[model samples]
Target: MTAFVLVSGMFTGTHVWRETAARLTAAGAEAHTVALTGLDGPCTAPAGGIDLETHIADVLTVIDSVGTAQDREVVLVGHDYGIHPALGAADRRAERVGRVVHLDSGMPQDGVPALAAVPDRSLRARLAAAGGRADTGDVLKPPAGADEWRLWGSTAGVPDATLDRLTALAAPQPLATLLQPLSLTGAVATVPTTGVLCTRNGASIETVQMMVGFGDPALQALTDPRVTFFELPTGHWPMLSAPAELTDVLLRAAAGEGHRLVPADAAVPPAHLRPFPLDVPEALRERHGNVDLHLPDADGPRPAVLFVHGGPVPADARPTPRDWPTLTGYARLAAAGGAVGAVVDHRLHDLSDYERAAADVAAAVEAVRADPAVDADRVALWFFSGAGLITTDWLAAPPRWLRCLAATYPVLAPLPAWGLSGSRFHPARAVADAGDLPLVLTRVGLEAPEIAATVEEFLAAAEDAGADVEVVDVPHGHHAFEGVDPTDETREAVQRAMRAVLDRVGRHGAP
Candidate 1:
């Protein structure tokens, strides 16, 4: 059986994990909870007696007592303040721990204590007043009652009963746990780690990386080769507010499943995939382009599809919010079929910016091809909606290395009603110029009459020009039908189209 050890945060003990542990136990797994030293009860250890090392020992003791088996796996789960001790212990007893999960918690650096990372002065003062110093009693606690919990933002999504229990059971945290600096020799770095972020505050891996510099050691730890990231829509204490979901995530983590940040209905096909951020220069992130990559689980020289998303072009001047789940899901589907998937964000202020967008696409394609993990010659382009207009340049004179291309409900011809002029961007004009390059076009039957007309006209032009084109029609589908309302039909449609694209591309054809 797999062993799951749960470590709770400041002022809270294993009592907070009752629901989560029960669920894990019910699922036939061994669940152990840790109540660290000094905070076990009132004055168990003198205020000044306990420090970071003491807690680390406490965690190690629990791991040792659990015993071990060759086939059995030991997973250490740490939340908030508890993360430091759990990770520290894992670093020391690296062989005993198989995996570590950090739930809405801060990671520890060798010389940095948990306190140094806190920026709120008022909170720091409150902590100091509660005994976080040498002269102080060395313990910190949340003020009593439900009102305080709400005011401190700790009660979000938490039930009244759980909140009351937490308030009553909460203990004073040992100040040293925050004040003492943590140290590591990189041993724990090898242990697989997963971060489950509570998204109630709208925080994501990208946002966090932006908040903390991309080079921060803590952030680097989160993206380590063995690490996978997950997001929970509820508040920080998922064990209390979202126990079932939290337990499910823990089970998946123990089983070594990869990332799954999408919603339940997002229809993301299962595949071994990893986040692959392109190394775009900071100078180009603003006006030029930005891209996100999802590579197949298999190693080196895999086929790849460079995706370009549809757009009307956001006028807000800020970066457009990309639907990461959908992008990753598409990539995963492609990965499942034995190819790497990439989503590129290019300049899209208006239809007039096609040239600039095309340049971005070209740059993104080069980057994907240059990746050691990708088969440079086996590359294809996939475009969706408005972004399909940019395909005009590709369809005009297909490159020798460009294997094939696919488009969905594309705006092949510019619509004057939408500020697009045929003279500026028109894929129909390029169809006649398209050579023997194979192409796949998906037409959504329920699409706007104008778009349907465009699809018909483009198909006719291409066929008349002797272009090798294949058309797949979704009878009752609308634009972005799957994302509009994911269903059995839409799901299967997407899978079918992806499979067809991979097969026709002749690049590592996906099964």
Candidate 2:
């Protein structure tokens, strides 16, 4: 049996951990719940008087008071606001705490407070006003109407009676707890961490990565290779809402089962890549502007493939490329082929934004290279359909890290819609600037009429320009045939192209 220290967030005590702890204890693991002072019963401290150190001490005391404190493996689990104290304790007792599970809570980074990390200004303001220590005295009640089941919505799968009990047993939390800044060094990060995301809250490892755009240290923790991410399809309080499911997740996390979630077969994509965050606006969350990494099994640094999905014209009901059946299927195929697959998202609406689209692809490349599992020196780019137009700039001035580029049914010429009238896009002109960069062009016989002339012209120009270009004629294939139909021939062609790329990079076999 394992041991777990369960910590609760604000407005609640060990009571909030009742359901989860019971389940853990039933599984033969010793579960200890820490209840901070002045949170449950009567209190003397002013609204902002209860500092974070006090809570940290509470958690530490529990850590020591438990049976044979150091006799067994221990995992400290923090939910919501409780993460602060748990973090401090983990830092102070780094050797003893084997793993820290952050359950749907924001990880306060160095020099950043929990409240300040929140991106939503209005929500931040509301939390501040509700519990501002200077204004509210020592403690603040749960936000008005927030305790009701409706506030939690459909995500809270718990019964009405459970919700009522939770609301009734809630206590006032110290404002200082929310406002306090965490003090952390490299030690806390050294402790293995797992992020248990609650799906309904629009919080996931991916969302945290997206939020990292604002330079939030808290969200940056998700990038740690030692960190594992899990998703529970419930509201913020899964302990009460979905005890059994949450319990299983907790057990698996304790057992270090996260790495198994992403299999070489690419059977099931993790939840982080599945649902789109609800908080982001549709325009900002457009399916075309996202990027994801699909890693294959690796013993060390391995060759990587950067894939650009086709479709130059944007569609209204466009699904996220990560969720698209064809794109993800291709990613799985790449994994099976023994290369780290990276799928990139870019603006497909305004043809003029091709430069920005190129940047998105570059960003994905950088992100993939950042992974220790990928070989920084060897990476290939595979462009599909109209997306091939975005790679002309890369061909013109190739980076040393890029080995080769492969295109399938590409649009090699710029259209009027691309807004390049004065400086029209032309890969034929860039062929001379390609500078020995290996290229493979796969042209389909049933290609779109609008781009046929340009493809033919570019092929002729490349032959004369002394550029090393290999052309593969898929006579029966159409634009996006692999994604749409994925005929046996198309699959074989893709496999051959990838193998050729690996052979060029000298990394063909699996490690």
Candidate 3:
């Protein structure tokens, strides 16, 4: 028999797990819902007195009381903020834990506080400004109403009554709980782990696999056989939105039955570090701050293409995008033809960095146009990956000097859980504003579902608005196809996209 211990996240208690726990019990599993100090059940601790240690002890007490008799397996399931304490306890009692389930939460590293996981950008910024330190009397209040639930996590698929109850029963989180850094002795590393992704809450299993391909040393552990993944279609609170499904997933997870990600080949270079597919000759290059210019061999002024790389790339990613072979290859290909090529590095370290990144790209364009080697009036902008969101600005207000725009595997619209609704970055809606500006879009058949949906949405909007758009299709390519899918079709798609964009700039610029 499997004994399950449930730990709820911030601003809620075991009350939040009532439905799911009942289902688990009905399914013949022993379910014990933990009531963190100050959040649920009877609490003798004063306001702000319950730090992470208090909650860690709370979960540990429950684990101890559940007992390991009859050789029963104990599964510790942590949801959101609850993962901190759950991890804290599991780290200390790794031998006793059969499995540790990360339910809709990131793998928190040692020395990071729970505040780092809070989804509200403004709230996180405000708390960061205070150094995540609060007085003994201070506490973080939960969302005040139904509309504010998004301030925490996506409320998709959750019924209206559940949202109301959640708001009404929400507890003020102790400031200390979030402020304290999680300390791990590394014992939990050996324990079997399962990641339960809440797709509508901003992450999917595919995204996780994509990140693992980035070759980040820290994320390499996810490739371990001991780690598995399960995705829930609902939002953050699966207990309320999809209790039965959540219970089923949990049971399967405990049984060690879930999908495992294929480990990236250690012998091959990471996707980003691989050589660019095309073999174009190098161009005369110059760097100005964050931008790199690859000049055409000809002396006379020429048309230019400014390439914008995709991101939410880690701020510390080595070699940067401008130095990457893919960007440099595209730039050199443009230069080898008849035009100058330019690449710019923008600060898009987080989803909220779009506005700032857009500003950076705009600044880079002005710098590129001002160069004596390039024709200011015949410049095209080409975007890649997440940078696709930044294209909305250009699409909404195309200047006369801007000749053409190109996007490759771009995310034209924000994901549902990104909380970017009504933002200026919706290229699908903004496409209607693009009057006479030519758009060259290169789409891959094997693109991730969420990203592909955005491209389709943009295409539909473009068709509805009668926008001038040209599409180059790679029927078997994946996102970042240059490195991942190096086929004749991939090379042809790249060349075709280059020709289409450069032709609009009054030159044939494909090598």
Candidate 4:
């Protein structure tokens, strides 16, 4: 007999698990839902406000009572913020837990507080300002309205009635529960783990596997046989949107019957770290602060292409984007074609860093144009991946020197979870303002659904505005296909995009 313990994320409590728990019970499994202090039910928060430890203890009590009485270990399932307390409890009583399931949540590391999970930027800033101190008596309130539900997580596929009920029953979460760092003795590492990804909420099984393929030491542990994965087609709140499906996944996860990710090949370098697909002779390089200029062999003042690498890349990422093979390869390719290739390193370490990143890129462009070896009157800005958002500014108002704009596997619109609904970085919306500025976009067939949706949105906008846009298709390519999928199609698309940009740059006396 399998005993399943459920823990609901921030705001609501055991009540949120009603449908899923009932389904589990009907399936002949023992279902127990935990009510964290100050959340749902009659449990009042103790003086000084309940912290993470209090919630950990709350889960521990249930685990002990159920495990002892039934004489069986339980499968602990934690959803969203609920994963914190569940992990803390599991760490403390690893022997009593059969498996730990992470439902639509990130893997919380030791010493990191649950506050990192808070999705609202304003709310996060406020909590950080208060220092999450219990003495501050700060309580983070749940989303008050229907529209605000997305601040917590994606509400895709969730019914209006469910959203109303969730909003009504949502409780105020103590700052302490979010502030206190999770403590672990490392005992839970040996426990079999299962991850339940919510695709519409921005994460999917494929993304996770791709990250693992990055050769990131931190993510390599996920390739372990003990770590299995299951993906839900719904959003963050699976219990409300697809209770039956959630129940089914949970049952299979408990049985150790989920998908396993293949370990990355040790011989081949990680996709991003791999050599660029194109083969071009290296160009003479000169560094100008954050920007690196790859000069063509032929001298007299040549046109330049400023390449902006995509990110939300970690501040401490190795080799930086300027040094990456793909960027350098493109730079070399541009130089080989009689144009100076300029790669710039920007501060796009977080989603919020787009403004600073744009400033850095603008500065880089000026530096490239000011160089004696480059033609100041002819320049093209090429963006990649997330860097595509920065193109909004250039697209809205094109300068005479700006010949063309190119993007490869770009994110033209912000995803729902990013909370950037009305921001200035929306290139899809900004495309309407682009008047006759030539635009080139290289789209991959195997791109992530969310990113692909943004590309589609941008294409529709471009069509409506009658913008001079040329679409280059990589039929069987994936995002970052330059290094990941090295096929003839990928090579042809790359060369085609280069020719289009250079052709625009070659035009004399541009408008």
Candidate 5:
């Protein structure tokens, strides 16, 4: 068995390659994920020093670097539009190119420029399926969960209606490649080839049409005696939504078995189902430009709860933290109390944008309002630790969608306490004017006997400012409400706090 060389398609980098590579490595084969040239953009090379040939050369370079020392044969896989470089690498290397697997990709044709292999991309096709009438070009937006948001600005915790609008705005792929034919004569016939198709309800009709085009007699030289064909029971992106199932199929393909028609096993069950509001779209976990913002995983509109991490955290801290409340203990509480949830992120530090952070929360709230699952009118905010102070300031002026606010172990009166000017960026004055706003404050005992008294004083201050307030105590824990899981005691405390706040805001039961 040869070392497996995996290549991701056009417009994508090695970010999504981890799962397939990991699975193959676990099965005992050396796996490598190759990054193409030009697409990665040259920061030092005067902007655009690379070309298509340079990219093909890059694939060859990866093979020579790793394949020479490992295996003579390779079970090469190409995803999306990556087939072009994969075939060219195979055609050039000749000996090292063993098996070429086109995973949900366009087939190559001889005498055609690389760009001609692209599939047909019409805004009309996408719009026809999405039930919209917009014309988008190039910037293929992620399907909206519920709003008018750019793909870069989208968070998974968005509401459904907003998602519908955003999804309708998805752009068309470049037709440059679709109009060209790929040259695969030299090494394609000698190598084993396979094609796996990804399909979904929202997928363009041309996907299957492209697959048929390659199988046509005019493309005979591109045919393979060892040609294996497969169709995935999923949309164009089975990888993202169904990684585990998709991984198994990818593994079978790499091992020369993907062409076979065996069903893949399902993904393992998640650990819990707590309910937490996740409508915020801040940068929860970010790696450079690859930020994974949160959105309410609920069906309709939620008030959209935005939670910011303390200063900045590393990207590797995944499962997004927001899921802890949404999938773990929060579910039990939400079921007992009947409240939709969400969590969101903002642009991270260094790359931080204060104006965008404020806008992101507001946009997320707007998205939550557009969702059918969440009650837009009952939107709120929950802040923890520094976030308590940050959100207090956020809610002070509050986005137009914000209806109520709740903070745990809040940082009361930061300007006066921290010696910062009101004009300074520390705390926005949203807290002071969170006018006639319904509020819930959760404080842990044992920090200071006077902390509760301080909360009472803050309540008095809020009352003076005409804000409604309710204070709840969770014993045996200090600040930040440590160990505040939804256990029986914790549940009662949360419920009591909820009932009081809802009563003040005049909201009860489901909406």
Candidate 6:
């Protein structure tokens, strides 16, 4: 039966949680420390990727286990940036939770990512002082050791590998969630909870202040009750720096003396499927004339459907796939010939200049047309998601490639982010500001009204620009389409997209 939930602080995980969990168990409380995705593994370089909400859901998963196993709810705890997930977890699993303990964690009273709460002076200095390795290009990774991290200041030591692990393991968290005002009116804070602050480091003073703000505003500002705030002289990690003392404090928590509250309803999915390994190829280089050719056998001749991959993320990554049989990237290749397959490697949004990105796609098209194996005349263009920007520009500004366009819930509207939403003439703006185009475009047909609206706008605009557009209503407007390929319905839609393109290829077959 579940008894206690021992959450770790930011930058650390169940590995650090081991000492605490063991002590709790020795005292007769069943304890489990949730190891969230990205944390358990290395992280992607500072290129900016990682999902905060999902980490919160992972905490919920541990608490939820109590529903099926224990009659009594578990005591939840959060540390450092860990406060975000811990609070979020409790919010989603209130019924299964008895109390929440914020162990010197930063709370987001104002929709800010915990990263913002982590002492900025410390991070900036570390980034400036330490030079990272080559692969990530200017992306700063965490210091390797505890001492090294101490030198870095702000955070505890996490590995350089953590970044690599995070890139593949973590998804890009929408900055909006971090920026959205937090409302715990009905959740964890109202429940039994406590805040245990370790005032050992001057580095965390700012973070602790932010943590105080996360509590109920009345207590935070006017007058207050309902929270037990404890301060210890130990440094960042009480469990490691001072385990026995931390144990005593936690035992008090086991007795239910202090714990603030948690909002009920934050469920973070724990682990995502592992990412397929990426091996960047030599010939895979982008050349001129919009060359988009697939190797049926890697050793085979020309192929069908050439995908123009997008930028920002590595061309390869896709949402975790529910269907394992069909490998990603190779999907279009699989569908080629009579099968209908294509591989798209998108331009790097932050890296490439305007002309260079468009030139890359243009080269891909030219090469694909020149390929002996493919019926250059019959070749098709498949753009995935935001990739429509480059594809659109290629089709709009330059000479046209073959016929037809297939977009899977491609992004249509400008970002809803404050500074992000604008009529600026950048990538998103280009698509939003385009002229008449061709062929069909499918926005996602999901239950989410927002996604539906966005897809509709993309289709409407594409149509206005002269492109034939179709909006396929995916049963549920979930992101499941990218990964869950096992479903027959999903398969059918994919076939339809390819078929439409194929028919278009037949008509617009190579010039």
Best lDDT among the predictions, by candidate number: 3
Model 3 shows how many backbone clashes? 0
Off by over 4 Å in 6: 42-49, 68-71, 122-140, 146-148, 151-185, 203-225, 258-511
Show the lowest summed lDDT stretch of 10 residues, model 4: 41-50
Ranking by TM-score: 4, 3, 1, 2, 6, 5
> Deviation in angstroms for 370 in model 4?
1.8
lDDT on C-alpha atoms for all candidate structures: 0.70, 0.67, 0.87, 0.87, 0.48, 0.49
Tens digits of per-residue lDDT for model 4 on 169-212? 88878778888999988998978999999888777787677566
lDDT of 1 by residue, 402-509 (tens): 778899878787542232442446788798888998898888988765566667888889989999987877887766665454566666667777878788655443
What is the lDDT ranking, best to worst? 3, 4, 1, 2, 6, 5
- Candidate 1 matches the true fold with a TM-score of 0.50
Clashing pairs in 2: 46-138, 47-137, 47-138
| TM-score winner | 4
Off by over 4 Å in 5: 41-46, 69-72, 119-185, 201-215, 219-225, 258-511
Model 3 spans > 4 angstroms off: 41-48, 130-133, 144-146, 257-265, 273-290, 316-319, 352-356, 416-436, 456-468, 471-476, 487-492, 508-511
Compared with the true structure, what per-residue lDDT tens digits does model 2 show for residues 21-127?
Answer: 99999998889999886675432343445777788899999887764554687889998778888998889888778899988876667656666643334445667
Q: Please estimate how well model 2 matches the true structure, expressed as its whole-model Cα lDDT.
A: 0.67
- Cα-based TM-score, every candidate: 0.50, 0.49, 0.86, 0.91, 0.38, 0.39
Q: Report the Cα lDDT for residue 451, model 4.
A: 86
Candidate 1, residue 205: lDDT: 53
Candidate 3 TM-score, C-alpha based: 0.86
lDDT, model 5, position 500: 54
By lDDT, is 4 or 5 better? Answer: 4
